[model samples]
Target: MSNQDQELLIELQGQIDQLLESHELQDLTSWPTEGELDTLIAVEQGQAFHITLQRDPLPSIPLTVLQSSSVLQIKHMIRLQLEKMEKNKGRHRRISWKYIWRSYCLMFDHTKLSDDNAVVSQLGIKQDSVLRFSRLAHAKGHHRKAWRHR
Candidate 1:
């Protein structure tokens, strides 16, 4: 990587650190706290610069880091990732609690509705009847409402 590219990666890592500190979500994972400088590899592939960000024991982030004179490219990349994560979350939220519970029961070889109430409570779901409907709301992309439900 060139000096300019290294500088850009360092800047991006700083921005990520700032974001994590501000969001207070860093405790959710051990990756961020393990290091100050997050080692990111930037590969120039054809016309695009592909950035591979390593996350501990999870998934690798493949981002096409754009080389542009425009000031908005960094902002654009952040926005794009945020939008993509939101969309992915929407898909996962679609998995109904009824389905989740059913699957949980089947997988664990457990039965008894009352004992499952704790799981439902953790999800802030009071009744079994509303599980599917609540998940549908989440699937429809009402994230705020879904969080409220939880």
Candidate 2:
């Protein structure tokens, strides 16, 4: 790295170390998640630094620090990731649905209406409608296909 980059990294590391030392144990749990920290960095302008401390669900504590030498670069990275995630959300949701459908199908044979009826009843779906839809879903090879088109 160039001298400027090295200096920036050192400065950021020191800030992070100081934040970890100064924060109280109980306060670290409330700190934001890693994803949120990334968003904060992306939105900030100019040189930006954040030190978050939180305590919850554990006693040791949690601390996050992010420092960006160039606000524009940080923002660009965040924007790119956000856009990618937005594009993938639908695909992820479809994958989750397919997983649930396959698990249910495995537990109760889709070929038998009686087995499917049992699942529909348990899940509070209308028996007649659910059975027809479940059969169609299986016949159309819905679960057999990958969730993501590409």
Predicted model with the maximum TM-score: 1
TM-score of each: 0.24, 0.20
Cα deviation of 27, candidate 2, in Å: 4.2
- The local distance difference test score of model 2 is 0.38
Summarize candidate 1's per-residue lDDT along 1-150 as a digit string, tens digits: 999999999999998777767644543333533322221221122322444433346454444433331223422343455466768678433335344433322111122232422332233322111111011223364444223443
**Cα lDDT computed for each candidate against the true fold:** 0.37, 0.38
Per-prediction RMSD in angstroms? Answer: 19.2, 17.7
Cα distance off (Å), candidate 1, residue 140: 46
As a TM-score, model 1 comes out at 0.24
